[model samples]
Target: MGRNTRKRRTPLATKAIAASAALALGGGGLIWANFYASAHESNNNAWGNQTKAANAQVATISCPDIGQKLTSVPRQARTEVDGELGNLDRQITDAYQRLMTTRDAQARDASFVQNSILQPLKDRRKAIIDRIKLEINRVGGSAPGSLDTLASCTGTPANQTTAGGQQQQNGGQQQQNGGQQQQNGGQQQGNTGQQQGNGGQAGNGPVAADFVDITKVQPNVAAKPQKSGNASTGVFITRCGVNANKNHNTDNVIVAPGVTNGAHHLHDYVGNQKVNAFSSNQTFLQGGTSCQNKNDLSAYYWPVVRVQDGTQDFDQNADGGGKEGNVGKILTPVQAQIKYVGSPTSKVVAMPQFLRIITGDAKTTTNGLANANAHWSCTGFENKVQLTTQYPICPQGSNVVRTFAFQSCWDGQNIDSANHRTHVAFADANGNCQNGFKAIPQLTMRLVYQVTPPTVQNGVVKNAFAVDGFPEQLHKPATDHDDFISVTTGGLANKIANCINNGQRCA
Candidate 1:
């Protein structure tokens, strides 16, 4: 399951409703309503502010194969990349906290500004970006475009160079709001008043910690390893085909067909050797397998979530241009689950090859309506649901888990639907498949991330996690999608029936 983090502004209509309520209530009641509305609005703003700073610090980094990139990256390479990013994250978090707590520096001279924040921020950011580029290239991927990492800082009060491009000291004279500050040898800094740089710390634009760290409040809950062959429990299994080798390519005709790198997004796929944008049932059955069980060939896939490097190139939405559907870093899933679910009397039936089922909608033009079913939880705190872009930051010993449940009730005929969803419906709360709809094997993916939560300050929650998708989309709990194919041989399907119906645990 993957998604993008976009700030959800209170709709104008919602705001109007709040205002109307305030007017009808009158006086103190109005005060409470207004306060509630303001707090509600602030939550979105806070997330927006934190995300802005976070993305800027990530700077111009390129992740090749953008879709299947993370999973394809070597395990050691991923750990190194995360370490580099985690360090930058910590630095930015510190700088943000400092800027938030520091007094306004409008009265401070450029020299003090340079030493206190600007220089350190620029030097640290440059080093991190350089390191990331080096690491990506080291792993056989192309390095990001060469950039003047400090270009954004050129016009700031500190780091301004002379007309001759020479380092200079200012005359220590106070300049007007839009006037040039005179430098040595008759040079002058530009009249652009305190431009916002890559490092969002300037005279009046001191960076504030937009989110409070919530790690302490929600401690981590460790997962106990599942024992095998308990016989008292039932399990479902999906033997997916080959791991999708490329990121942007797809074979699913329902979503995109014959489109190479056409998703303008990335996705991770398992199952169906011929899986791509144009794949059909015939192609899927002929494809090879990536799964250990060669007899069970099926397709399973979902979007990829990347960690943004400072370049802001991951998604078009992150840059304020919503033309493309998804951009930014694509994160890999932590774990996955596949099983057959039906009534006690029902038995497992092989689903048609290339049968496509998408659970979460990825192409959400709006924020709230998409990702309606995406589920996020702490390993031990499964009941506490997290729905926003700021994914849960699990406490020590616990992991961040994402769960996607696909519809199991198929129409018994159509392998696909126009909307890519209607062909199936979810199993009932009692775990019973719907009437008339045949219960096929249900595939659920549970992805876990081991990440320390951002330090919460002032009671605000800061999210350290970012998902994969269009940055303009909300990435709410609903964007998670899952696809499946049935390659289960007749014998394997019966085995599933015996194991599940008889209440015997088998994996």
Candidate 2:
């Protein structure tokens, strides 16, 4: 055995170990790449695709879902494993379609993102949706699903209740909790039923209103100013709203310059010249919301929701790395997100919020139609809760500039975009700056509540409240008002009865 320090061992053992090491390293890298791509390719953009031009440069979105399984498969086959991920792609489409058609308002809550779609697939869906959105933004455009995905994803999705809620998905096309009549068959409660509680009767409340849909854009592009600068819908508002120390007089404020910053109104924001918010093909997905001090540093007032990264996996079998996009996108699911917790469902709610006139206060103008600058501002909500809307395309050659705050009350604060930030900052500003924050001569709101007769036992009856953590809750003590007043339904007060039972608390 001493023929030169024992017979030489076969080289095969060394080769095997080295090969194994390379294989493991490659596999780990591919997985990491998948996550990397997902993070980097999000569409947290605010400038919607309204202003984009068809001739603009379009970025390609490659979502390849493939992998070199850890079998003894040959490297040649693995390297050439280019195929399709139709199943996964279809899953995403199906989810989006489902989101758009859902009757349950809860499903569209911002926090429901993870609960309904992404987390369930273990990030597969997340990455894909995020990437698709990123791609859309890159091309200065967006897909219909892009809107659907963020439609109700206000918080970030995946709330503490998501997993629980999914498990509690009562077995029925429509769950009958206490034999209540299911009225969600696209029925309009008219103006009366929308504000009044659905206690099986119509009452003399604020009277039912209607949502106005703009069928076409006005050809004229002139700016209009308000007269008195103070108008109100004269409806009741929730407690938190009042407690926020805000002036329900938002309706009273006017966009002095008119359309100065919004989609059609931004002519002043850029002096009639188009300004693009995004200059590259990158995408940004809205991130989960976190509590931030509005009165704190202006820098952190609106931190980006999406955590962006670089590098994309273009290899069919590779994950998030390799190439910039050979691999499929799979962003993570946001947890406990909320769009707008306990938003109102009547025009009266919106009247105090979104509407205003450029002229004198309070006129019963038409909701959505071309008017002769009679009503400078336009907004209507609550009455029938206009869930979703797709705005008209911008005039030719004008791509969407992406507004920071174009949102539905149902959007919650999930987006926390520039449009909203601008408004918030404007409100916080003084004098002239605040003057144009909201359209002037707007209608104001005040909220009122009366307990359902049969549901109450005595004066000590149970009540409803909207709270921070509980989105469906309210400020405290509900009651109607004539003009401007704040109300956050919580604790107890005049509305309470001696008995405790089901109390309808609509925020």
Candidate 3:
């Protein structure tokens, strides 16, 4: 059917926050109507004491097995759905607050009229519906409701038609671009405006579209770690601890600013409640963390992983349509180390909060794959040759290990640089602080995937894996990166100094 000929009842556009308003109206109207009908029926009860007991019994008899069937849905799907729903709830809450507080209609309209959340929410809801149906079918039960029967506002304002037409045109252009990519055998890797033909030798290999060429880039080889203090001198404190559990679910404020529902995808965080593009040192310290150390209020975060059967069923782009989530569950690192590495005698002072640094470049999508500092191996294959593969399958009893080591040598000045780098350089191979640069506490993050494998598929072990990165990154393991915030206070800093220098294992 032609685009306009196809039928969909949901309203395409509105001057106000149409979805929220519609949801509110439907919910309130239903409740009020039900209450009124019940009251009227009670009045007609011939027996003045009309069996309130029988009705109560009927209310208590709950539906069977639907909850059980829901459990059958994959955990990754469940988490994705829940995350999206939570995000929508946040949007609705913000919208309601704006509507209640704002006197100006224009301002309210501006906040609500944007289609970013509307379409994405609809897509997620539909996904949930489809997943539920599949689960029900697998369990040999009838679906609770038909997809066509789902309630949604239909009809479009005249202005929306024009916008929709333009969107369709843009989509056509994108399709053409996709065709061009196929003709050239692959997509372009945007690095310093360098264009390597997809078939050219300089291009990244078969999986290059998903990774950066890390082999060629001057990798940030970490300095040999050294302990700073001695226990005999009373400088003993544990500089390392792991933050394993999740603390919050939110969108990336740094890369996809202002788009609350994540124009890209959702991220899971372990520390710093107020993490966003505007989050600062004071903000992080003021917030809390899931870390064992209350004083070590640093933030460690990455994208939630979802396991997939290797299908291109996601957006994989921060600014694209279709599936906007990664294809697999992101296994938490087997060990996440939070410690200081640098010159022990430097006597490091306070580490500032919101000092953001990314260890790997998510933007590079080719020859740059090996250009990252990703170390991947199985439990038993710790010594196995590690390469920059988009995904790694480990042997049975072994999980995939991913580690990220950040630049340690700071200029003794800026917390951040203009390019988000350059202010800090890596320590020398000898573990010595760089010349003219002061040794700062270098934070490191390590993640391990739970793809216990004895199996191999496509000549590689099959594993559930993903990295926290831009969708354009294609979830390539090479694109995996880590973010950190220094929430260390005075006492904690003193302890860290002692632990690293004194060579104590105290936590």
Per-model root-mean-square deviation over C-alphas: 19.4, 29.1, 23.9
The candidate maximizing lDDT is 1
- The C-alpha lDDT values of all candidates are 0.39, 0.18, 0.37
Query: Each prediction's TM-score against the native?
Result: 0.49, 0.18, 0.48
Better of 1 and 3 by lDDT: 1
Candidate order, TM-score descending = 1, 3, 2
Q: Which candidate has the highest TM-score of all?
A: 1
Candidate 3 lDDT by residue in tens digits, 287-369:
77565667767666665544332333233332221233343333445565554543533544334444555555443232232
lDDT, candidate 1, 398-470, per-residue tens = 8767676566567787665433455566554344456577766556667666655533332211222344443
Tell me the spans in candidate 1 whose CA falls farther than 4 Å from its real position: 1-233, 238-252, 309-330, 342-350, 363-371, 383-390, 452-463, 474-477, 489-491
Better of 1 and 2 by TM-score: 1
lDDT of 2: 0.18
User: Which has the higher lDDT value, candidate number 1 or candidate number 2?
Assistant: 1
